[model samples]
Target: MRRPDPVSRALTQVGELFALALDTLRAIPKRPFPAKDLLEQFWFVTSVSWIPAMLVAIPFGAVIALQLGTLTVQVGAQSFTGAASVLAVVQQAAPIVTTLVIAGAGGAAICADLGARTIRDEIDAMKVIGISPVQALVVPRVLACVFSAVLLNGLVSVVGVLGGYFFNVIVQGGTPGAYLASFTALAQFSDLVVGEVKALIFGFLAGVVAAYRGLGTKPGPKGVGDSVNQSVVVTFLLLFFVNFVATTLYLQLVPGKAA
Candidate 1:
């Protein structure tokens, strides 16, 4: 028999991933919720991701502030530097950083763990005993990612803003009052709402993609490693695409704060 074409294979995998996401979501509202698993997974994800997310956020925020500060000075709009830098961090960088950390750290671990189980036949054993691997395993990990992402998004935002503030004020000699005032002048509360929303959606996507790849592991240690890599790459692409779409919609639908 002829093998499927590349496009067809890709489409088939996409369909399988979608089906797995649906199955996991359906299992979420069922009885015997995996509270214990959820707690443990949440702790694991948070522990692995928090420090890295903060460390990354500091540099990310500093770079944004420095670039924007220089540009604002040249344009004679220096007072808006804080608003622009902080908004950029809160709206874009925070969620992306949070998702990246979760995917690279927590998501990889989830994929590898599940893939190992698949190789060992533990997943099959659960199914034979009438246990849904989705509920018993996937759901907890997914929800853990969601919770971790949301919480880490907030943490990154705060850390990023502080980093930006420090660079702008101390290094660039920007006035503290003007910097703080500019944020209130140009930033709407909706900006923050959209950022958190992005974190929530990104988290869910990361979890689903990781879990899907994990469950589809090809039955070897090498396959487990490949699945983990694929999960991270796929999640990164999906997160960026979804972030663009969501940002576009928000810009078109929501009015900006009057400066």
Candidate 2:
């Protein structure tokens, strides 16, 4: 039989991952949920990724303040600088930062761990013992990714806002009261919700892609390396595409009018 084309093979792999994700989701309602596994993975994900996420966020926030603060100051609308900073960071930067950490750090870690297990026959050993690898391994990691993304998004928001405030007020010599006062003037609760939602979905997709690639890895060091590379690349592509679609729908549906 003729070998399938690369596009055909790629489509098939995507469909397989989707089916696996659906199966994992279906298993969620079945008791007893793996609380212990979830917590352990959560701690692992957060401990590994938090610092990097914060580091990226602070610089981004500062840059935004530096650019926007300068522009707004020239127009005599310095107070609105804080609001713009809040809107931009919370609505876009924070979520993207969280996703970068998830796709780069967290997803790579997951892929490496599972790829090691795959090449070592641990997965097959679990299957021999009648344990489902999806339940025993993938589910907990997925939960951890989602949980960690939300947690990191919150940290990013705080760091980004504080970084913007510090840069705008301290470095740029803006009035403290004006910076703090107008911070929430144009932001809405919907922005926070949407940001969190973006983080959640990005994390879930990252975890799923990593797990799928890791599980399908062949028995070699090169295979594991390829899986890790593919995991990061695919997760990033999915993230950007999803971000566009999600942001568009969110803006259309909520519009997030300030109170």
Candidate 3:
């Protein structure tokens, strides 16, 4: 075989990584859904994460509405502002933005937890006892994130719409009913389903990527922090990359209509 160029080698490595991830997914145990674990995950996403994500989304919505209003005033078709705002925020802003908040807030917490576990030799101990670390550690966290993301995205979508409307109707006194009508008319079930699907993928990815990095930490104090930081950076990068590819595939190649 001839020597490969740097670009080709990098691509090959990425391919291997994807293949390994697929293997891991297939290896996941086919067990009953853990209700208690899911409940806890819901709590984390709802009570813990929902408010913060909403807080971030609300301000984001306000800013978008303000900008949209300013832009549309000259065109005299400001009635479309609400539809525009909702479409923009829901696609990538609400769910994707909530993922951002989660990475900084909840994601860091998860990273630190795993890092500490690794540092204290708990992971080693689990392996020593013939336990699957993926099941004990990775699965629960992943489940929690996936569940939490659904709730957080739902909250963000609702709050984002309301927040955008508040800015449009209350702040700018734009036509609230007209905006709502436009949104309802144009908003398809496909958009909502796509947003939810994105949230699920994003949430699962956030947990797995963060846990993987965090669990790989050396058994030390500094290692814990370093892993957490790295987890955040890596997960952030993956989130964007996945978004681009997933959305492209979703819009262009995927079939069966929107919903």
- Taken over the whole model, the C-alpha lDDT of each candidate is 0.96, 0.89, 0.77
For residues 1-259, could you state the per-residue lDDT of candidate 1 as single tens digits?
9999999999999999989989988999998999999999999999999999999999999999999999999999988998999999999999999999999999999999999999999999999999999999999999999999999999999999999999999999999999999999999999998999999999999999999999899977899999999999999999999999999999999988888
Lowest summed lDDT across 10 adjacent residues in model 1 is found at 212-221
Clashing pairs in 2: none
lDDT of 2: 0.89
Judging by TM-score against the true structure, name the best candidate: 1
Cα error, candidate 3, residue 35 (Å): 5.0
Estimate, for each residue in 62-126, the C-alpha lDDT of model 2 and write its tens digit: 99999999999789888788888888899899988897887788789899999999999999999
Write down the TM-score for model 3: 0.85
What is candidate 3's CA lDDT for residue 69?
A: 84
lDDT tens digits by residue: candidate 3, 208-247: 7677767778778889888888878877888999999978
For lDDT, candidate 1 versus 3, the one ahead is 1
Model 3 lowest lDDT segment of ten: 250-259
Stretches of candidate 1 off by over 4 Å are none
TM-score of 2: 0.93
